[model samples]
Target: MAHNQFELLKQRRFLPYFVVQLLGAFNDNVFRQAIIGLLGYMAIDADDKALYTQLAPAIFILPYFLFSATAGQIAEKLEKARLIRITTAMEIAIMTIAAAGFVTQNMIVLLVALFLTGVQSTLFGPVKYSILPSVLKPEELTGGNGLVEMGTSISILIGMIAGGLIFALAGAQGPWVAGIAVIALAVAGNLTSRAIPPVGAGAPELRIQWNPIPESVRIWRLTRKQLAVRNGVLGVSWFWFVGTVLTSNLPVYAESYLGGSPTLYVFALAVFSVGVGIGSLLCEKLSARTVEIGLVPLGAFGISAFVFDLHFAQPVASMAQGLTVGGFLAQPGSARVVIDLAGIGLFAGVFVVPLFALIQSRTPKGELARVIAGMNIQNALFIVLAAGVGIGAQSLLGWTIPQLFLALAIANTLVALWIFTIVPEFFMRFLSWVLVRALYRLRVRGIEQHVPDEGPALIVCNHVSYMDALILAASIPRPVRFVMYYRIFNIPVMRWIFRTAKAIPIAGAKEDPELLRRAFEEIDAALADGQVVGVFPEGALTRDGAIAPFKNGVERILERRPVPVVPMALRGMWASMWSRRDSRLGRMRVPRRFRAHVEVVADAPVSGEQATAAALEAKVRALRGDAA
Candidate 1:
């Protein structure tokens, strides 16, 4: 019930888990970068350094592909907090081995430790995300996810910076420092893990799946069971692909194009990571504390826009070479390039957070960890594919880095369009969200307290304008299957939005009995399947800015399905442009007020048996008060 996302950071339920994940991510990056730093400390040749660098990522990622399915099963079967502690404890042991490798300056031992670190990470992956829904409410999902993403971005950036500096600052003592640093971080993460209060296992009765390959395939199939969740998983994988491509090229992009040294490369990465953290924090404010997938399309196109600009921002190679970070920043067009990098990361954060929340919210809790496991497997593939694609485009095709970026921008747009096309829900929500926010400053009361969170419920509201359903859709947290008059449902461009939203369209019995019967059937089915079905009990828009008589549709729906009835009212909408107030001439007119203040209020639910149409209407009228 924390209203602010930052509030959760102060609470025991979220704080310890947050710190644990942050330290873990920090440790992972630190260990990885320390390995890179060790090359310099040991004075390894450039060729050997390249070989080690090439081998390291593959070694690190191998466990995700090999053991993620088994990891998912283990996460499900074992209690979540205990599982987390075990992973952290394992991290302690793994980092101990990594420390030994660092002290001994043994590449073979380091690689083995790196692979073990990947195994530990793979084991932690499912629970990292799957634990959020258990600890946070549905409304908190977006904010909680945003915070986690922000923490991760910042931790990775800082860890890389900290680890990279060890050799540079400490000289001959770099190895010992790196060794102690990673071990200390591991210990810190473990200590924080101990504070994460007990979270029950998702599927305590689940049998462990020993074979990773077949189990991976099975879990992958499980992810596809729900259309939204399936696409969400795909979106997350695509994010990894995009991130891999973009981040992988930064070093060369920085050194070659920007004409800067390694410091500038880290600077570029730092800006991008900061942008992601900022955008992740912004999700809560933009989404109004709801799991608003509408942001996904916005994030998608924003990424393409900034990345496309990035190509033009630095289309040609720099005339100057070996510039420092400050020198690079002093050059013309440098600000634009920095902004583009930051913008891409910002949108990337926006794009991925909602999808994670969506997947967590929609997937069955019992299967969530495994589904995340499936997602991780796919993400690994995408990351590999991204590396290959980036390499192929530059090495084989002989494309410049800017040209590669141009291709990425175009590819990102196409992929986003394809995903939105397959699942119009993402696009539909985007459009509705845009329209609602543009037209009204919406305020809500009693919804979070009164509206049923999990089970089926019928929402009866007083209809005031044509935009009622869309407004209500934006205001309500859950997707409501709104039953609207067929005419409004079929309104030219709006028809597509309505249909994609799965809004039930009905006609009067006299107009079309078959359609009416079908609409009723759909409503009943939706309610029976445990969905929120919204209907304006007035059955038509009010003409005189007054509530109309309640229609019997509400009574009929209740008599059939008998779900909990929530009475809602939309105030300040009657005078809006979409209303019937000035429609006597049957011609459109400019709105009297742009960005009007609107209030959507709901009263406590009435039992289905007790909710007569008249009683529901009275409740809505009372909720509306004298606002109309």
Candidate 2:
């Protein structure tokens, strides 16, 4: 119930991790940009500069492909806190070697340093992400990721500036400055890692594997076992690919396409990074602090739309030569380009944060690190493929950068459509989120900590409106199966959604005895499989604005399967357009624009043996109180 994420920074559990990650990100950028700057401008002769600069990035990324599997295994097999400390120590040693490379002005040594730094990051990757779920509660995961992402963006921006400044001002002393700065940051990171609470290994008994390729393949196979987790990982990897395409081409886009200077390029990066930070921070607010997968579709749409728009936003009048930062900003139609870039990053943040949270929450704890390792490998592969696509399009096909952006936007659309089709639950959740947000101003209380995060349970609620099931489905963080009257469940407009949610539809025993019997059997099967099933104990929708008498069907369900029953109440929905308060035509007269207040309060769980139909009806009425 904290108002903002900043309060997390004041606590020991999150603060130390935050500081360590921020510092690590800053160090990575500082060393990388510094090395790239030296290779591009100073250390290498003009003839060889291009080759070394191109080689630098490859060297940095190679470890992810070669060692991510082993790194994942290491994280799983060792205590996380110790692994973090060891990774931090490795960082210090790597930076020291980098400093020696800088001092001796040896390009080979520096490249080796880059490769080793990449290895350090490869090892750190699994630990950094896997530690989050252990350290933060389930509800806190999204917010924590948002903060880490924001810090990383800002750190990269600052590190780039610092690297640039060191190269410019330190002159011959640049190497020493870079070396000292990285070493100091590495030490600080190590200290911060020390303060992290102890985290035992997730898979301590697992045997270590030395072969990288087969191990990588094994882990990747494991990752693909879960459809949702696989899609989420693919989505995350695709984001990196799109990002690589954009970032790899930005300088060319600035200098050649937009006719802009280094200042202008930096300005563009700043806008994009800041936009991502803002969007990441906004996820908690938009989803009401839940891991709302609905935001993924929205974000994908925004990214596609803005990227497509960027193709047309290019200026008509060519400058023929690059412009100064200020000159570029002053040009006509430049604002649109800036907006497009920022929007791409903003939507990217929205797209990425939830997938990470989803992967963490859904993956088994034993395989969490290895799955993350697989994701890293996929991300690396995608980044390389993105580079290949960029090269083939621009060099082989003669496409302009704007043309490439358009192509990527189209590709993004296809990828999103494909993923959504493969997993319709994502689409269903998106519709549920939009529907509830549009019609009602919803307030949910006690579900965060009270509702079992994983288990079988029964939810008993007053049947107030046709929207009751939809509202509960949207509000609860986990998937829930609903038991509803066969007529309502089979409504032509809503049947598909009901089928998608796997809601069990029942008829009166006298009317359709077989259907009622099958419904109860299905409910029992669902509970046996550890799924939540929600039942409106009233057996039918309330005809008047009062709680209907609870039926004995709940008693039968409890007798069949003795699980905990949660009592809930719906308030302020009786007069909503979905309710049957007036004539059918009268109810549809005027649609509420939005912001109609409604509240769903869940009481503590009661034992199934003790929760009689009358007692539950009375409990729901008390929970509803004066509102309805």
Each prediction's RMSD over C-alphas, in Å, is: 1.6, 2.0
Candidate 1 collision pairs: none
State the lDDT of candidate 2 residue by residue for 48-140, as single tens digits: 887787788889899999999999999999999899899999999999999888777788898998999999999999988888888776677
lDDT of each: 0.91, 0.86
Model 1 misses residue 431 by how many Å? 1.2
Q: How would you encode candidate 1's per-residue C-alpha lDDT over 485-529 as one tens digit per residue?
A: 999999998999999999999999999999999999999999999
What TM-score would each prediction reach against the true structure?
0.97, 0.96
Error of 1 at 458 (Å): 1.3
RMSD of 1: 1.6
Best TM-score among the predictions, by candidate number: 1
**Clash number for every model?**
0, 0
